[model samples]
Target: MKKQFNRMRQLASQTVGRAEKTEVLSDDLLQIERRMELVRLVSHNTHKRLVSCLQGQVGTDSEKRHKKLPLLALCQTMQDGGAQLGDESLIGKMMEVCGQAETTLASELMEHELQIERDILEPLYQLAEVDIPNILKQRKQLSKLVLDYDSARTRWYQATKSSNQAMAAKVDSLKDEMEEALNKVEICKDQLSADMYNFSSKDSDYASYYLTLLESQADYHRKSLAALETAIPNIQLQQGQMGGPTTPPPPITPLNSPARELTSTPPPQRNGSVYLTAGTPHSQGGSRGPSPHLMRRGRSSLHVPLKGDPRGRPRIRWEDDISKLALGRLGIPQDEVSSLLELFPSRPDS
Candidate 1:
């Protein structure tokens, strides 16, 4: 209880002395403390905001099975939707490539955020929560000790000036207390000054950490830009096709159309031969060839009676392919092909 009262008294005295501008804090130390306090406040808030951004940009593990950036999630959704639309769809193809680019961007962004957390946010947090706070606590302890030393000195001086000799022992004890308090104040002041100088020395390092963050941010934007630049032209090309003309399909012909009959008519026969004249035979008449009755039959017209064999006896011979010659002349139906063959006897060579 006595210790608590003394602590309260010392705090009150220190507060009054500081307010009256009589506490006499070192100018450099005061400036360092003030700057450290600001750093702690700003950095702590920055850390909080960065963490919040991470949670929002990339969902927490509990919120998402595989913590994905918001854009990554969107890209995945687009990719799946594109696949569902099938390979031939133009929009589907564009979505496929766009989603791939966005996926790459999302991955890069996630990497950047993680790097920031590691290099910037984590260090800021340490400065705010640990390093600066420890230094400030030491400053506060030093302030209290200074107040205690002052109080001890005042008491010792009063005891020495006492008109009563009976107070000599009390004076000696008070002087001892004053000396011990001064020793503590000197020690704490030395430690606080050292910490302030150390903090000041690290100022450049803090600045460079922010520069590193900027570099990371610039690299991230470059990647994102490259991805978008590649995607935009393809998307534009697809967009341009929206109103262009399409080729019409070829005309379809009916299976039994007259046009087919016209096409089926044999082109005028050449040199009195049908498909081939290699083994064709001719009769004695040469030009007159087969009789009119046989000539009337398109299949028989294919036969040319040539001069007889060396023996001079007349012979009949037709093209090796009887069906081809008949069918090639008239558009003979497939079902009548067998009947036409029976009309022309098989060659003896068969």
Candidate 2:
């Protein structure tokens, strides 16, 4: 189509010579094409919000009908539902080792979001969708070849001011169409000023690849805090072997506190009439036998308060053949026959 109507009439004569200021360009190549169109609109919205934050998905047809899991695949589906609801308990093995340390920290955060989408969003989407839009489309074809070399040097100075000898062969064909439109605007202004000085010298190597993507996101959060500090000592040793009532109890014993005194004997108070004394080694002629403080308070069974017994209530009698007697027939004193057979306490027959 006649070269798209002569490139839309050379973009409407360079938009009427840039609205009459007569078409411009070099304000340092228009401030490096407005700082490369603000670095291509901030690297095309930072490579579409970092590929929708590493595919945790905002696919966008109004959130693509909403089904997007990814908190590390919901932490590996809560570590396979806490290892199938924790079989060997201790709080289900501390929720199956804290969901297997958050599913190995979500597989090291999905290999650190696939190494930041392969080294920082594919080189910032190849410099915002292909090298600064191919250097702003070769600076709009060198602004329509500087408006076709100023409309062929104004028709070769109006055909050399018409002194007319048949206008000197139309002024030598308008001086070879104004020297072929000034050699195509000096070869597209020397290849768009060498691609805007090679994109300002690679902008410091793209800011050191964005500081190596923040040092690989601080080494993926220090390897997810060293895998939750190695699963917190196996969840505190399974909460101390699943212990219970967790502690604080045993002190009460009060309610008017008196009773607990009896270690046994209290019987042979002769003048008070309570006798049954048998542990006799020999307390001299007084015949007082069971006394070295009741033979060092060892024996126990001694409820002896029987006198005329009209049920005055003190007849406890469990001597049960005192283990078939024979410590030399109970003349006891073999160092009190093991405290009289430990105060004789058996009672089978009535």
Candidate 3:
């Protein structure tokens, strides 16, 4: 009975030891699973953050630089009239920002992924050392974990590829937009230059025309003043001659008197014409009337002067004689001179 009791106690002690060792193994497995879960949560959070950053929710150096680049370029364009702005500066800044963000995110993701892998491997090693059955069961779980990890890794890789592709596309789009804007600016500059040139040309033409008009007006006024100056002296001389007074005349001489010859003879009444008496031997007949030839001759010799020449002013001669003038000057032939003179009478000056 004593041997059997001792055997039973030893058996219970062995069973208790076995239970304790199993409990310890279970605890270690649970710890390892908890650690793996923690690692998964940490990795997931990091991946979520990285995705958010890639999706533009979390700002990175690339995002900040992209946001600031347009504003900086706009300010520069405004300040310098678009002349000093360039695409090189903007593109360089964009590349720098993308590189920085990529490096930082890649480093962080790799570190977290490595840590999770190490943690999962540690549990796998411990399970191998313990119960072979537990290790086998955990191997199945580990295979699932590996699949999940592979899925996560694939997602990360796909996300990285998509992010890089999106970034490249965005950069290309921005470059195209910038190039179009620059072309518009250049067109505006050319238009402004053309307008300025036209305005300057018009102003110069107007100035020249105005100066020409002024010179023409000045010349006209100068000619008018000269004509007035020449006419002033002639007007003054005419005024002086008209301002003088009139004069009286003298009486006739005694030898030219008519009353002394009529006392020696009685006058006889003849026909209507007057007849002069002749002395004794010189006269053919005292009763004969005046000769008809003498009367005709006296009538033909009578001359009448022009009405304005009552005081008998001397005639003013022209430089050339009208009768002896050439046909070209007189505008008529010598044979036709009488008819031309009848049509247009010759003036005393001509």
Candidate 4:
């Protein structure tokens, strides 16, 4: 008897519990429209702010020589270049955000559909298959019982007044069963109303939170852009100084001989001097000209660098033919070094 009573209560509940109306889903997509609008608005605001932040800026012509440029203008050019780099880089980041926004909305919409499938549509399918048909069968059984009860009661009263009282007693029992079923249906309907309202309210709250998420993303990008604007100048300064030291031409290295031998030969000098124009090995046809070592040298004076040589000093050999001379230390030639020393008396270092 208890099992029968519980089944009866269950049937009454299922019959009265109408499909859960997802009024949040049913509302004419106003919330979706609002969210999409926010996306557009945020994108426009981001682009506008980025443009305004890096607007009216000049860039340099790379083909032009930076050395010919003034220091102030060079610094300015580097600064502008850094700002341009930051702007372009951040614009790319903004584009990434745009792509994410578009795809995220698409996924959110798919999720909402899945939510509907999981929460409302599947359970309603169960009602259609089992509960609804069961309720229909119970309603038909009650209708047939009503007719039978009426016929039985009428027959007992008129034609068979002496008939058994069980016939009338069964009709009263069926009436009580129908009354209980009606009360259960009323309670089930009330519960379904309360439950669906709460579900719709919660769904709307989730949608509101989705809007908050978009606002947060936009805020993050804006802060990053501000940081970039401040940091690019120092990067410009570093890049501007990336070029290393400038190198000058190498100095001339003097050679003393006709042969390709190392020598230290000094350049020729002319001055007011009265020297012997007589027959001397240094004189030529009564008029003396400076030696090849003095005029210039047998080879170039410029120090040619070899691979393994550490010191780049000039390898000049100034005492070329002087080694062949048989002069002693005490018997020096007056027409040579001692003579030149006497000629230029003031320059001892030279």
Please report the candidate that would top lDDT against the real structure: 1
List runs of model 4 lying over 4 Å from the truth.
Answer: 1-167, 199-207, 244-350
| Lowest-sum lDDT 10-residue window in model 2 | 267-276
lDDT of 3: 0.39
lDDT of 4 by residue, 1-350 (tens): 65355445444544576212112222333343344345445544543453343212213222232322343243445445545556345443333333333333333333333343344334434433443344444434443333333333333344334355675566565555556554554454444334334433554543443365455446545655554555455444433454423345565444534443534343343221222112235434464544444323212221232324455343233232221231332233425533433322121231
Task: Quantify all predictions' global Cα lDDT against the true fold.
Answer: 0.68, 0.64, 0.39, 0.39
Candidate 4 achieves a global lDDT of: 0.39
Report the lDDT tens digits of candidate 2 across residue range 88-206. Answer: 65655566667777767767766677677779888888898899999999888877766666666655666788677776688888789779877877887788888888998899987
After superposition, candidate 2 runs with Cα above 4 Å error: 1-55, 58-71, 74-76, 83-91, 103-119, 126-131, 134-136, 143-147, 150-191, 221-227, 234-236, 243-350
TM for candidate 2 is 0.38
Alpha carbon deviation, residue 45, candidate 1 (Å): 3.8
Q: Write the per-residue lDDT of candidate 3 for residues 1-350, one digit (tens) a residue.
A: 64345334444544566311111123444454444444445534544453433322222344453344433344343434323433244433333433333344333333333333334323333333333333344444443333333333333434546657765455545455445544544454344334334433453543443355345446545654555465555544543454522243555645555665665454542321221122233355444433445444422332212335445433333112332443444344454543322332122531
Positional deviation of residue 116's Cα in model 2 after best superposition, in angstroms: 4.1
Q: Positional deviation of 23 in candidate 3, in angstroms? A: 81
TM-score of every prediction relative to native: 0.58, 0.38, 0.18, 0.24
**Candidate 3, run of 10 with poorest lDDT:** 271-280
